[model samples]
Structures are given as C-alpha cells and as structure tokens.
Target chain A: MLQFAAIILLMLGLYGLLTQRNVIKIIISLNILEIGLNLFIISVGYFEGGLAPIFTSETPANPNFVDPLPQALVLTAIVIGVGTTALGLALARKIYQKYGTLNLDEMGEN
Target chain B: MLDNIEVLQVLEIVIAVFMVVLAFLAINSKSLIKAVMFLSALSMLSVIGFVVMQAPDVAVTEAVIGSGLVTSLFVFTLLATKKVGVK
Candidate 1:
C-alpha cells in the first residue's frame, strides 16, 4: 500500500515538473519529487514490529530493528533538497528581476 | 483506535490521496500564490504521511524545512520580484 502511494506521488511530481512553466512552480515540483523518493527510502527500511536501531543495555542483544541505512540516506537527501530549493528560488528571483515575468515562454524571447 | 495498525494504514492512504490531489491543484492553479498555498498543503500532508510511515525524524525535517522554511523562502523570493510583490 505504501509503495503504491509512493509511485503515485512520483508520477504526480513528474507531471508537475514537465507541465509547469513558472520557475517557482518548477522548484515546487522538484520538492514533490524529492518527497516521493524520500518516502520510498524510508518504506524500504520498515520492518513489522521492529524497533529502532538504537540499542540500550536493557534491550536484548539481538532484536528486530528497522534498517537504519535508508533512514540515514533520506536524512541526507532532505537536507540536500532544502539547499537545492534555496538555490532554485534564488535563481527564480533573478530571472524574474531580469525578465519582469515568470512565464517561461516570454523569458525565452531574447 | 489510533493504536490499531489497520487504522493507521487507512489514515495514511487517505492522506496520500489528499496529497496527490493537492499536487495537481498546485501545479495547475492560475494564481501563483494559490499554487504556493497548495504546495504548503502538500507539505503538511507529507509530514503527516511521513509520521504514519514510522519516520519521525523525517517528519520533523519535513515539517520544519518543507512546510515552514520553504514556504517562507518562496514568499520572500516572490516579494523580491517586483512583478510578484506580495500578490
């Protein structure tokens, strides 16, 4: 069920990315794409009734735990998404300032 | 009850469906601010969905950076452009 949702989210993001002409909307679409990818990574780490990877002396030495790798990877990806978003928005601001319009078609004309 | 896994699964699916609708609305909205608002709604739903998926850390990050920080950044940039000033 989770995987199905993730796929739909990915397709929605791709649709927005392909169809949107405004630079800010493009950046927003990129964010949606990042979210879908992140969700998939976290879902890959899930284990039924599994504990987090943290270990305490009171806990059993060998216990079921959700995979920590994908969580770490998604953490990194989320930060990178933020940086990319900031950069994209800055560029959009510059484009708007220069072109005085947010439409891609108009910006393309000289 | 919220403790039931089945209930949680149902809730997660509902949120995901809402997010998909919001994504389409966001990308297709004629007004840029309306699009931004839809994006904000999408971010909020994603945060909730992340929590439902057993990713509390990711949920926190998404809530702070995705919904709050990114929305502010969008608004700031929109203001910076004279053509999109506070509209």
Candidate 2:
C-alpha cells in the first residue's frame, strides 16, 4: 500500500519538475522525490510487531526487529539530501544575483 | 500481526492520500514561502508514516532535519532574496 503511495509521489515530483518554471519549485519537487524514495525503503523493511534494531543488556536476546540496513541507508540519504538542497539553494542565490530572477526561462538569457 | 488490520490499513491509506494532496499543493502554490511551508507539512506527515511503519529513528531524523532544518534553510534563502538592502 505504501509502495503505491510512493509511486504516486514519484510521478507527482516528475510532473512538478517538468512543469514548474521557478527554480525553487524544482528544488522542492526533487526533495519530494527523495522523501518518496525514503518512505518506500522504510516500508519495505517494516514488519508487524517489529522492534527497533538496537542491542542492549536490558533488551531480550531474541526479538523481531525491522531491517536496520534500510534505516541506515535512509539516514545517509537524508543528510545527502540536505547537502544537495543547500548547494541548489546557493546556486539559486547566485542565479538571482546574476540575472535578478528565479524563473528558469528568465535566468541567464537576458 | 495486528488483530485490527482493517482500521490500521484504512488509517494508513488516509494518511498517504493526505500526503499526496499536500505535495500537490506545495508544488502548485504561488508563494514560495507557502510552498516551503507545505513541504514541511508533507515531511511532518511522512514522519508520522515512518513511526506507524515501525521506524522511529527515521522519524526522529525526518522531524529534526526535514521539518526543522530544511524549512529554515529555504526561509533564509527567501528572506535573503526579499531584503533589497542585503543585496
């Protein structure tokens, strides 16, 4: 079910990226695409009654835990998303400074 | 193995639908600030979805960075552009 939603989000992001004229809106669409991927990965690892994949003396020796690999991977992806977003925004700032406009078609041509 | 699968599945479906709506609105919004706010709201909903999917760690990270940091960064950029004195 969540996978279905993720697919929808991916398409929505693609639509925005293709249709939006503003640079910032394109960035937002890319972020939405990242989030959809993250959600899909997490959902793939989920199981009913799954505990967090943490080990401690207090924790029982045997327990069902959700797959931790996807969580770790998503963490890395989230940080990377932040970095890319900052870079994109910086480029947008530079573009605005150069062209005084954020619209895709209006930048650098005039 | 939840006994009440129907209710939980229905709730998840509803949340997912709302998330799609928020994403659509965020992309379509005219004001950049409002669009960023809707993006934050979408992340918040995803945080809930993560928790419901049994990933609390991801939920925490999403709440902190997605809802908190990203929104602030976008706002800062918007503000920087809006203030003519800065440029």
Candidate 3:
C-alpha cells in the first residue's frame, strides 16, 4: 500500500515537471519526487517487530533490531545532495546574471 | 517464496506501472526545469524500490541527496534564470 502511494507521488512530481514552464515550479516538483523515493526506502526497512539498532553493555543480545547501514548511507547522501543543490543554484544565478532570462527558447545556445 | 507470491506479484505490477509513468514524464516534459524535476522524482522512486528490496543504504542516499539536495540545486538554477532565454 505504501509502495503504491510512493509511486503515485513520484508520478505527480514527474507530471508537474513536464507540465510546468516556470523553472522554480519544476524544481519543486523534483523535490516532491525525491521525497516519495525517500519514503519508499524508509518503508522498506520497517519490520513488524523490529527494534532500533542500538548497542549497550546491558542490552547486547537482541536480534530483532533494524538495520543501521541504510541510515548511515542516507546521511552521506544528504550531505552530497546539499552540495550539489548549492552548486546548481549558483550556476543558475550566474546564468541569470549573464542572460537575464529563464526561458530556454529565448536563450539561444550560441 | 510461493506462499506470498500473490502479494509480491501485485507489488511488482504496481511498481512497474509507476516506473513507466514516471519515466515518461521525466523524458517527455517540454521545459528543462520540468524535466529535471521529473528526473528527481524518478530517482526518489528508485530509492524506495531499492529499500523495498532490502537496500536501506541506497534508499537513504536517494532520499537525502536525490530529493533534498538535487532539488535545491535545480531551484537555485531556476531562480538564476527568469525565463528560458534573456529577453
């Protein structure tokens, strides 16, 4: 069920991207799409009775803890994403200053 | 595997349809910005699918970087440009 919902969200983002002419709206749609994917990933890790993957001297024998590897990877991805977004934005700003428009049709690639 | 085959089959069908739709949207969009957004959405869906297949690390990365950071970058770029061309 959750998977289905995630998929729907993805579709919606895509639709928005394709349909929207404004650059900002397209970016927003892209973000929406990413959120859907993230939700799906987290949902996959959900086990009916899984516990948090924590370690302690007194509680080291539990075998039903959730996986921690994904969490770590996700954190790294988040940082990278931030960097990429910043760079892209910077580039966009530069383009705007140089060209003074967002309409791709008008900005001939000369 | 056979016991829950029916449920898995349903899931597979749903996922397949979703992917097809998203792929089309990403590539077929008229505007460059819209296309980028669709691409992000596609990335996110792939992350979720990975998680469902027992790959949590991939899911996390997709969620954070793909959705969060990438989108921001696209937005910034959009802001930089008022239109596709300089009028």
Candidate 4:
C-alpha cells in the first residue's frame, strides 16, 4: 500500500512535468518526483518493531534495528536534491533576466 | 490489529490524493507564485507521510530541502521575473 502511494505520487509529478510549460513549475514537479522516490526508499527499511540503530554499553545484542543503509542513502539524496534545486532556480533566474518573462512559450519567441 | 492497518491504509490513500491534487495545482495554477506555494505544500505533505511511514531522516530532509530551500529559490525566481501568466 505504501509503495502504491509512492508510485501514484511519482506519476502525478511526471504528469506535471510533461504538461507544464513554466520553468519554475517544471522544477517544482521534478522535486515532487524526487520526494516520491525518497519516500519509497525510506519505506523499504521499515520493520514492524525495530529499534533505532544506536549502540551503548547497556544495549542488548538482539538484532531488531531497522536498516540504516536507507538512512544513509537518503542523506545523499537530500544533498543532491538541494544542489539540483539551486541549479534549477539559478537557471530559471537567468532565463527570466534574459527574456523578461517566466513563460517558456514567450521566451521561446526571442 | 486489523483496525490499525485499515486506518493506516486510509491515511495513505488520503496522502496520495493530496499529493495528486497538489501536483496538479502546482503545474496548472495560473499564477507562478501560487504554483510554487502549492509545490511547497506538496513537499510538506510528503514529509509528513514519510514520518508516518517511519522514515524520520527522510522526513527531516524533505522538510528542510524540499520545503525550505526549494521554496525560497522559487520565490527568488518569481521576484526576478515580471509578473505574467502563461496565456
């Protein structure tokens, strides 16, 4: 069920990307899609009853902790998402400055 | 319990629906600023959904990058551009 919801979010983001003409909207949609993928990745590590992956002197040896790999992967993904958003917005600003408008169609006329 | 799972399923469905609606609005809204706001809202919802699904790290990242930095970037771009909607 969680996977299904993630897929739906992915599709919705894709639909927006394909249909939107505005550069900013396109970037937003892309972020939406990225979030969907992130959600899917994190959901993969969920266990019914898992402890946080921490170690202490009193910690038990029982291995019931959720996978930490996804957490690491998501940290990387978040950094990448920030970089991409910065680049996309910078490009949008340049597009706007050069064209004086945000509409792609209008900018294309130049 | 079965009831808990059922409730979770219902919550998931609601989140899915909200995501779809926000995605559509983000793309189709006439005002660029409004679209950006919608996108931010979508990101926030996704973050909440991630938390509910037991992904605290991802939820934190989404709230920070998706809702914080990205929204600011969009607003900056909006300010840079002349106010005009796609015809």
Candidate 5:
C-alpha cells in the first residue's frame, strides 16, 4: 500500500519539476521527489508482525524485526537530501540576486 | 475490538492519502510560503507514516530534521530574495 503511494508521490513530484517555471518551485519539486523516494525505500523494510530493530528487555524469546539495513541507508539518504536542499536554496538565492527574479521566463536572456 | 495491526493498516492508508493530497497542494499552491507550509505538513505526515510502518528511528529523525530544518531553509531563502517580500 505504501509502496504504491510512494510511487504516486514520485510521479507528482516529477510532474511539478517538468511544469513549474519558478526556481523555488523547481527546488520544491526536488524535495517532493526525495521525500517520495525515501518513503518508497523505507516502505521496503516493512513487514507484517514486524517490530523496530531496537532490542530491549521486552524480548519475547524471538522477535520479528523490520530490516535495519534499509532504515540505516535511509537515515544517510535523509541527511544527504538535506545537504542538497540547502545547496539548491543557496543557488536559488544567488540566482535571484543575479537575475532579479526567480521566474525562469523572466531570467531568460535578460 | 480492533487489533493494533488493523488500526495501523488503516493509518497507513490515511497517511498515504494525506501525503499524496498534501504533495499535490504543496506544488500547486499559488503562494510560495503556502507551498512551503504544505511541504512541511507533508513532512510531518511522513513522520507519522514512518512510525506506523515500524520505523521509530527514522520517524524521530524526520520529525526533527525534515519539517523544521527544511522549512526554515526555504523561508530564509525567500527572505533574501528581492521584490518577493514575505507575504
């Protein structure tokens, strides 16, 4: 269920990227894309009757823990996503300063 | 009596639908700040969705990092831009 939802979110993000004219809007679309990607990746680790990978005193002889590998990878990916978003926003600010407008059309050959 | 699993399943659907709706709204919003707000809301929903899917670690990280940090970055960028006064 979540897998499909993530896919739909991805498609929406892509649509925004293709159609949006503003630099900020495009960056927002990139964010949407990353969120959807993370969701999809994390959803892969889910399973019925699964608990978090953390272990504590409440152990029941054996336990079904969701895949920790994907979770860890997603943690790293989230940090990277933040870094890239910051970079994009910085570039956007520069674009605005240099071009005096964020609209792609306005920036064209001006 | 609904079992915990059943409730979570329902939650999964609700979060997914809300995520999609919010994503759509975030991108399509007329005002840039409104779009940023929608993106933050979507991030918050993703945190809940992660928790539902048995991902406490990611949920905690997302709750802290995704919504607040990203929104602030966006808002700051908007602040620096000329002719686009915060509205």
Candidate 6:
C-alpha cells in the first residue's frame, strides 16, 4: 500500500512536470517527486513490528531491526532534496527577474 | 498478517492515501500559494507515516526541515517576487 502511494505520487509529479508552465509549479512538482522517492525507500526497509535502529541501554537484547541502510540512504536523500528545492526556487526567482513573468509561455524562447 | 489486520496498518493506509491525495492537489492547484500550503500539509502527513513505518529519525528531520523550514522558505521566495506580496 505504501508503494502504491509512492507510485501515485511519482505519477502526479511527472504529470505536473510535463504540463505545468509556471516556474514555481515546476519546482513543486520536483518536490513531490522527491517525497515519493523517500517514502518508497523507507517502505522497502519497513516490516511488521520491527525495531528502530537506534541503539541504547533502553533497547532490549537481540533486537530485531529493519534494514538500517535504507534509512541512512533516505536521510541523505532528504538532505539532498532540501538542497535541490532551494536551488530550484532560486532558479525560479532568477527566471522571474529575467522575464518579468513566471509563466513560461509568456516568456517564450528569446 | 491477513489473519490479523492491525489498527496500525489501517492507520498507515489512511495516511498514505491522504499523502497521495495531497500530492495531487498540491501539484495541480491553480494558485501558487495554495499549492505550497498543500505541499506543507503533505510533508507533515508524511512525518506521521514515517513514524508508523519505524523511521523516527526521518520523521524528526522531515517535521523540522521538510515541513517547517521548507514551507517558510517557499513563502519567503514568493514574497520576494512581489507577485503575491502582502496586500
């Protein structure tokens, strides 16, 4: 079910990317795509009643943990996602300044 | 698992569904501010889903960075453009 949601989110983002002409909208689509990817990665490492990978004295002996590797990858992905989002928004602002309009159709290819 | 469907599973399903629906609305919304707001809401919803999936680290990071910081950044950018500045 989680995978299904992820796939749907990717589809929605892709559709937005292809159809939307607004710069902010395009950035938003990219964000949705990243969110879906992160969700899918975490879902792959999840299982019923698995323990979180945090180790401490409070944890029990012989703890059954879900894959910690995917969580790490997702952490990196989320950070990269933030960086990319900021970059995209910056580019959007530059585009707005260049064309005096956020709509790509209005700007055209000059 | 089929023999006993847990409430947590049911809740997970509901959150995932809401996440997908919000993604749709956020991407396709007509207003830019509205889209950003929808995305913020979706991020918070995903944090809940992350906790349910046993990813506490991701949930904490997402709640702080994804939902809060990113939303504020987007709003700031929008305001800077003066296209939808304070009226």
| Winning candidate number (lDDT) | 5
**What is the per-residue lDDT of model 4 for residues B1-87, given as tens digits with 9 covering 90 to 100?**
678767866887788788878877877888877888888998898887776666676678778877998888777767667553433
Q: What DockQ do the predictions score, one after another?
A: 0.60, 0.68, 0.16, 0.56, 0.80, 0.71
Global lDDT of each candidate: 0.81, 0.86, 0.59, 0.77, 0.88, 0.86
The alpha-carbon RMSD values of the candidates against the true structure, listed in the order shown, are 2.6, 3.1, 7.9, 2.9, 1.8, 2.5
Clashing pairs in 6: none
Q: For all the models shown, what interface RMSD does each have?
A: 1.6, 1.3, 7.7, 2.2, 0.8, 1.2
Task: Please list the residue runs of candidate 5 whose C-alpha ends up more than 4 Å from where it truly belongs after superposition.
Answer: B82-87
lDDT of 1 at B8: 77
The DockQ leader among the candidates is: 5
- Residues B3-75, candidate 6: write the lDDT tens digits: 3448777887998899988998998788889899999999998888788878999999989999998898899
Model 4 chain B worst lDDT window (10 residues): B78-87
Ranking by TM-score: 5, 6, 2, 1, 4, 3
Two-way TM-score contest, 2 vs 3, winner: 2
Kindly list the per-residue Cα lDDT of model 2 for residues B1-87, writing each as its tens digit. Answer: 565666668878988998999999999988888899899999999898888787888899999998899999898988877832221
Model 1: pairs clashing at backbone N, Cα or C within 3 Å: none
Second chain alone, TM-score for each candidate: 0.87, 0.87, 0.74, 0.86, 0.89, 0.88
Fnat, 2 decimals, each candidate: 0.52, 0.69, 0.23, 0.65, 0.69, 0.65
lDDT of 5 by residue, B1-87 (tens): 349889888888998999999999989988888899899999999999788778899988888888889999998898888434342
Instruction: Report the number of clashing residue pairs per model.
Output: 0, 0, 16, 0, 0, 0
Point out the higher-scoring one by DockQ: 2 or 3: 2
Ranking by DockQ: 5, 6, 2, 1, 4, 3
Q: What is the interface root-mean-square deviation of candidate 1?
A: 1.6
- Considering lDDT, where higher is better, how would the candidates rank from best to worst? 5, 6, 2, 1, 4, 3
Tens digits of per-residue lDDT, candidate 1, B12-76, equal 77987888888888878877777888888988988887777667777888899889998989888
Q: Could you give candidate 1's per-residue lDDT for residues A13-83 as a string of tens digits?
A: 89989998878889888887887888888888885566666676877878777888888898899899999
As for TM-score, the candidate ahead, 1 or 2, is 2
Looking at model 1, residue A35 earns an lDDT score of 79
How much native contact recovery, as a fraction, does model 5 achieve? 0.69
